[model samples]
Target: MDRRKFLSATGLGAVALGAASTSVGAAPKTAAPAAKGGPAKFKLGCQSAPFDDEHFAFFARYGVRNCSSSAKILDPGRIYPTVDELKTLTDMGDRHGVSVDMVDSVLLTSSHIDREKNPAIMLAQDPQRDRDIEAFQTLIRNCAAAGIPAVKYNMSILGVLRSGKVKGRGDSEYLAWNLAEAKPPTPLTRAGVVDADRFWERITYFLDRVAPVAKEYKVKIACHPQDPGVPPSGYQGVDRVLGTIDGLKKFITINENPYHGLNFCQGTVSEDLRDPGTEIFDVIRYFGNRKKIFNVHFRNIKGHRDNFAEVFPDEGDVNFLEAIKVYKEVGYDGMLMPDHVPEVPGKPEARLENFAFAYGYIRGLIQAADHLA
Candidate 1:
């Protein structure tokens, strides 16, 4: 269906949850408990980098109840942490009152994969494939032992690539990426230009090996989508998979284990479709209704595909209220964290300011949607 028709059918224009007028004046006030009822339908969370007591405290002050720690905190040198180390990190979360819902951006380094010359070789049938698989299994086991329910990761050899910046509110700098104006970097592996089929085959092999292990550990593997949208076939000397809906569906279908699911990055999926409203909502319902969404990166952008700027939750193209409504409709009870908020300029507490703004904005939306429902 056309974008306009889809918007009309989905009642996008009818959404009344406009931007909140109240400025985030100070550190967030402690949220009051729900009135004599069951638990909240969904929880608010954030991905704090350099995850530490200070960061957890900051989030807690803003009423965040769950968090995903930066992968670096778990494995500083990209070597997987031991079970004791993982438990220590979880203990830190308990002290701060924020549950560590997941570990963000877990990856196997070139050294662990044992393919320093071209780590992408590990993505295919390489001599070091066994080593790479073992590294991932160990990481998953340790995370599960430490009480982490999910692990978010990327399967692509090339991670997120952005080209430029855009001005946001208060002249804050937000990162932007335009594939049309960007040059593709050279392929990283000796086995260059792996086709889509080859990529799928290799991913299937990896999942086949890891899916059983994940089920055994009772931990979900949340596969993140390719960022900045996949380039046109062969545009970047590679057939980019997992950047489209079809690619994502294939990824999920390849492994039937309930433990294999999506990280459900709203912004990246919207960028791939190049429509942040209707298309984004459809994808949300598609995966969320099926319970394939393990977690969510709840952020928004001003544009789509290569030409986009991450903005405040309400200021972006996606109608977050409607998005939250869909999540409720689908019964998605997992963590939904604000990802990629632009820095507010000049404030000594710029990160805190941005995060507080996002947290308040999302919290308001969630409440409004639930009340309306």
Candidate 2:
């Protein structure tokens, strides 16, 4: 089916979809908006993939006041959430004094292309694309109803590609990705190879449909960059966009809606370019200045693009102190969370322990930056 027919049939056309507004009647119960002069104090948070009550307790214990949880918390088996389910989840967070600020999970079903599906449709393809868009719209509405501020998503068809684990500072295992060790790229769809242009077009199509809904709901849409790194060609199976600074600029400009921004993965950005330290600072300055950074995956890495080892925030190549300063200069007042950490052997609470360490380190940076300011 052609684009026009597809949109028409799916009721995605501007007028038709616009008429069926998804805004909820009641506003979510949450904190007051920060005053409009200088930057507001930012919150430190974490993602609980398999979100549960225990996760909240952990966050509360560590004095983490924000959370980015999996959409699975709402419908364990599906990607979408009903209003009631969203309310229940948010209420759970509230009880522990932690705010459910964002929700994320795998929006795409498969990592690689399946020959059984039409390449054209599968790439930007039909029913699935339509359903995904609707699911995202519903998610935005539900987030608004529950007072969640953002939805983080990734557009990469290839997903994350990691090679092996590498040893880190404290004899911990960190997931490493080296392009040399990476598997060869395969066709993303049965039709053949997907190009950068096509990948971006699909992304634009998604944003066009969803951004308006997000705006109406007052929920920000934050796109995650292609993880590991975006290859000169594509990585592991498809062309990756939004991996570099240029790509990120393209992404933010694609939709003019203020609600369209980034989840801002610091480690991924550091890994995407040749000079991570310099480039990462520039990225934060550029996006943060525009207030397009809705949240942050505040982690660090050992190397640059195509080959890197994940590391704790303090031990990486990037100067996170400068990172905090940049965020401050850009007036970013969003949640910053440690995206990844090493898994120490023989440690039952390795993740939590790593998080606690990261929390302390980042908190120190924020405080130090404030003092300098």
Candidate 3:
């Protein structure tokens, strides 16, 4: 099937839910939109920076042009001058010749797990939900004021776990059957997990409330696909969100908003597609330029169904050549990060080395492609 047709088949029709009506302050007209240029030389970035902004100065030093960062640094509750602090960080990045391409939402992923354990953190639940909403709204407003372009949020509710301690590998951090301990081959149900209906209601409400403000502030909201390619058991009370290709399609189709986009994690979807290199072109052809794809995680796995390992970005089952070619063909200008690399041996900093290797390799691919052009 073609990319457009594939997406259409997977997309679920949905309506915007109780979206907030508040307006985000006007974006300054002086800030220019991203220029249409040839492919950018990709770079290596971490979801969380181990050190201060200074640690990432190496990106600019190496001519690595973009950095994908966590939105945590801009939290007003934790720190002050939140918006200016972010802009200053970005400005420093520009000074070093590195640009902040995307600000990933922290509230849902790791933060969600933390909230799950400490129910008080969940803003969507009861009295806390209202306060959480207000706090999050303030965050969005802060990001807008900082001139941050996009914020990606995930909808995974209960955390997935497999029972047992995972063994660590020298090449990577730790490859486990499940991040959480749980029985395998269990029956799956949408149940109380982040269901399609609940996701639509929450996301639509968020987008409707935030999209216009984001537009006014010149920022975009990108949602990531549910990881693991399956729903956590409803009976077990495990949470799952956007676990399939169809789930992702439902997210975009439901809102039917251009501002709504995706964080296309190749590894997660590869669990479903089996051959990552094969259907990727279709995804790009369909979601590309349509403005649905905002960021990409370039990782690979060994097996297709129910089992896999995170391998070196260069040596994975996914054909990087075809993937890069498809990305270029579709004019994808979004950030492509070498995600979840195997840890190197004994250095204690193997991830950084793996990231550098992937970054260099992808850059060479782009350069080679550009030469052919």
Models, CA RMSD each: 9.5, 13.5, 10.6
Question: Over the stretch 1-373, how does candidate 3's per-residue lDDT look in tens digits?
Answer: 2233322432211211111111112321221223334643333444436424665675655446777665436545552236876687677667767777667543555333434532323224666554555555555677778776777766665443322322233334434333223364434422334444565666666555566665566676777665565443332344344655555666676546666678777776665443444554565556775768878887775434234455666655577666766666667767777776666446767666666777787677667656444
Cα displacement (Å) at residue 210, model 3: 2.6
Model 2, 218-279: lDDT tens digits are: 99988887775555565544566666667778778876688999889888887775656555
TM-score for all predictions?
0.82, 0.82, 0.75
lDDT of 3: 0.55
Best by lDDT: 2
Q: Assess each prediction's global lDDT (C-alpha) against the native.
A: 0.69, 0.70, 0.55
User: Candidates ranked by TM-score, best first?
Assistant: 2, 1, 3
What candidate 1 gets wrong by more than 4 Å, as runs, is: 1-40, 70-78, 105-122, 185-191, 344-349
Candidate 2 C-alpha error for residue 258, in Å: 0.8
Worst 10 residues of 3 by lDDT: 12-21
How far out, in Å, is residue 344 in model 2?
2.2
- TM-score of model number 2: 0.82
What's the true lDDT of residue 301 in model 2?
A: 79
